[model samples]
Target chain A: MEGSDKFFVVVIVMSIIFTGLGTYLFLIDRKLSRIEKKLKEFRGSKNNDK
Target chain B: MIKSMWWKFLGLALVLYSIIAGLLIDVPALPVIHQTIRNLFYHVSMWFAMFVMLGTSLVYSIRYLSGFRMRDDLMASGAVYTGIFFGLMGLMTGMIWAKFTWGDFWTNDPQLNGAAVSMMAYLAYAVLRGSIDEVAMRARISAVYNIFAFMLLVIFLGVLPRLADSSLHPGKGGNTSTMEGLDMTMRMVFYPAALGWILIACWLLQLHTRRRALIQGIH
Candidate 1:
């Protein structure tokens, strides 16, 4: 392959990898935030009884 | 958060727009760039959406710091996460366009570097939030860091790209392109794509925030 073509392939690969990583992080952020909210609500109710 | 009717309306509009942009508009073909122009619909739209989200989130962060309210913190978090989504969309679409137009995937160019830096800063925001366990303390610290991050994002995305000496993309460093060769149909498609994607971003953020509230209320 020509140098430019090889470079293009590399760039595409990097883009795919980074895009995947970003998507994964986006999912994790939502999941963790939900968990945090649940814990907060639980603590809030517990404190209300006391 | 928006109601279900909001999404239904937005979805219908998107579908109609797709038909108009694709079939009704006689978009000029850039043979050199091939299908790269298609990426414009996604890439440019996402950048604008990201900017809006980050700006909104920064506002909430400041409010949280001033008042120490939990709702502000939640809003700030919502904006940040949505901003990250738009950022990813922009990067992915840009990469595809770069591959065809530049005959390579990566250019080590100014715009690319700026975008990469902004993404890293946002990632750091998440990490910074994670490091602090106490709600009040976390919100305050993250707000301070977010202010710095917003400054960096503005500089990287808006200022540096224009002021720098080198770049691959067009409209870099004070140079603007006129619609010298663009046809009417291209304009129609381009305008709607930009507007439609922005609406979609806003709509998604509302849905996400509502879902969070619902889950919070139920448990």
Candidate 2:
């Protein structure tokens, strides 16, 4: 407590409100993976038709 | 982003921890950079992440040369783009830090100039790809160029900077032990921050590769 700075608290508090941004990035990454998988399967099935 | 969930979560957790701990942790009071020492968690972490992603690009480019697979080329380009993004961030952050400590936004330091040269070389890779009309030719040529760019990257960033007699930046001018200044508390946060940013760079590269793969597959 003796050596602590108050600016840290303000920035921390501000950062708290933006906590979900990383979760959003994570979700988009997962969603993109799903899309990529589906596209791969579609291509595979089409290749089988020939 | 690489069809892996655990590493992404770990990246997020570690970065979040570093953000909090980086702020709260006590740093050694040295001249010129007092509280700004906390910037080590961010500015240095970014350059590390940039190196990791660009190194991945170099590896994938070599893989493409061996196999000539379109997918490997896509991955190489994706890693390059992500690496460039991180490198740009590193430059911006360095500029900000330099303004405070070195009393100028851009100095004549060899380290800083070398970083600029490397960034320009990578940027040319993107421009080279865009100008090519054919897919296979673009991939092959750009893959080759990517390797050359990475070699230049290693030279400009690693070799030229150290050959200088002195530098405003740490770890330059034969002063290789930049991490030696970190104490235990700083080390705890800095290591996690570096690793987290590297993983996050991987996540971004995977995202770019997947999107590119999907787009190429549709055509």
Candidate 3:
């Protein structure tokens, strides 16, 4: 491959990797937010019962 | 602590910018490095992020020792886990860059060996954390070990490598420091890339810590 072609290939590969990683972290963040909301609701209900 | 999402957006934006700029920007077409020099923004940034994460872990470990808070212990563990992830990424990227530039995936360079040793030390820290069954004992013992291991990491990555007679890695021996070698354009992307990766790692750590907290609360 030509030098510019190789560099562009690297750019595509790196973009894919970075985008994939960012998406994974976004999913994890969303999951944690859901779990946290559930925990807060459970605690609030328990406090109301008391 | 993970409530604010603005920093997360900022981190993602900066990283995306770095990815685009690092590739397209003109770089010094030095002998042996050429286009592969762009790996500096990616690979070296991973190590910088790792150091930040590890340093944060050490601070939390010290706090856990002093106050014995479960939250601090969780933060410490989460930081270490994230730090190790970055370290592994750094090593993998380094190996690929080395293969292209240095003609081998692995070499006998002091910096490389020191990095390997430092990673092994952290892995041992993880194993140590896993071995104990008691919560309080595990936290206390692991906190102490984390502090010691972090010191070892500094020595291995920072002190020992520079002390070597020669190294293929830049900024060691007679080679110019990595910062000294970069031009203004590369430096602009490089600094932001490092900061972005560090922020992203911290975000991951915050997520891990929150998950642990939720699990503990459920129990």
Candidate 4:
């Protein structure tokens, strides 16, 4: 394969890998935010009982 | 700790720059390496970020040992997790680079073996953390182990490999390919790539720690 062509392949593969990893991170962040919100609401309700 | 988003944005921007620049920038077309030299920005930077994360883990481990705080323990564990992730990525990328350049996916080089050993040592720490049932005992014992393992990691990855008579890796055994000798064009992207990766790893550590804290708080 030509040198520049090999590099282009690398660039595409790397971009895909990074994009996938970034998307996974974003999903995890969203899940954490949902869990945190639920916990806050639960705590607020418990405080209201007192 | 998650209040500000400036550092996260900076990390993202720097990494984006590295990705684009690393590809388009001109590089020294050395024999055998040629375009594969661009792996320097990705593979080497992963190790750099891993070291930073593991160093942070060591500091938090020390703090946990001294203060016995659960938060410090959590931070130390989170950092280790992130560091291990980077280490694995570094190994995978290095192997792929090596396959192209060195004609094999693995080598008998001292540097490669040392890196594998160091990673295994950290994995043992993770297993150690899992075995103990009591929270306080697990934290205290694992904190001590983390400090010991990190010291070994430094020696394995940094010092011992350099002392070897021969190494396939550059910048070792008195080789001239050290970072100081890197072309200015490459350094322009390399430094930022390393720093950006470290920042992103820290961001991941913060997120991991926060999730752990929230879960613990609920329990």
What's the number of clashes in each of the models? 1, 0, 0, 0
Estimate, for each residue in B31-128, the C-alpha lDDT of model 2 and write its tens digit.
99989999999999998998898888889889989998888888888888888899899999999999999899999988678778878888898999
- Assess candidate 1 and give its TM-score to the true structure: 0.71
Q: Write the per-residue lDDT of candidate 3 for residues B1-219, one digit (tens) a residue.
A: 455788997898789889988888888879999888888989999998988988999999999999998889999988989999999999999999999899999999987887788789889989998999999999999999999887876766666666788877776774536687678998999999999988898888888888888878732
lDDT of 4 by residue, B27-54 (tens): 9879999988988988999998888988
Q: What lDDT is reached at residue B61 by model 3?
A: 97
Q: DockQ values for all predictions?
A: 0.04, 0.45, 0.44, 0.30
- Candidate 1's TM-score on the B chain: 0.84
Q: Candidate 2 regions off by >4 Å?
A: A1-8, A14-18, A40-50, B1-3
Q: Which should have the higher TM-score, number 1 or number 2?
A: 2
Q: Clash pairs of candidate 3?
A: none
Ranking by TM-score: 2, 3, 4, 1
Model 1 residue B73 distance off true place after TM-score fit, in angstroms: 1.2
Cα distance off (Å), candidate 4, residue B94 = 0.7
**lDDT, candidate 4, residue B140?**
96
Q: After the best TM-score superposition of candidate 1, give how far the Cα of residue B141 lies from its true spot, in angstroms.
A: 1.0
Per prediction, the TM-score for chain B is 0.84, 0.94, 0.94, 0.94
Provide the clash count, candidate 4.
0
- Candidate 3 local Cα displacement, residue B117, angstroms: 1.1
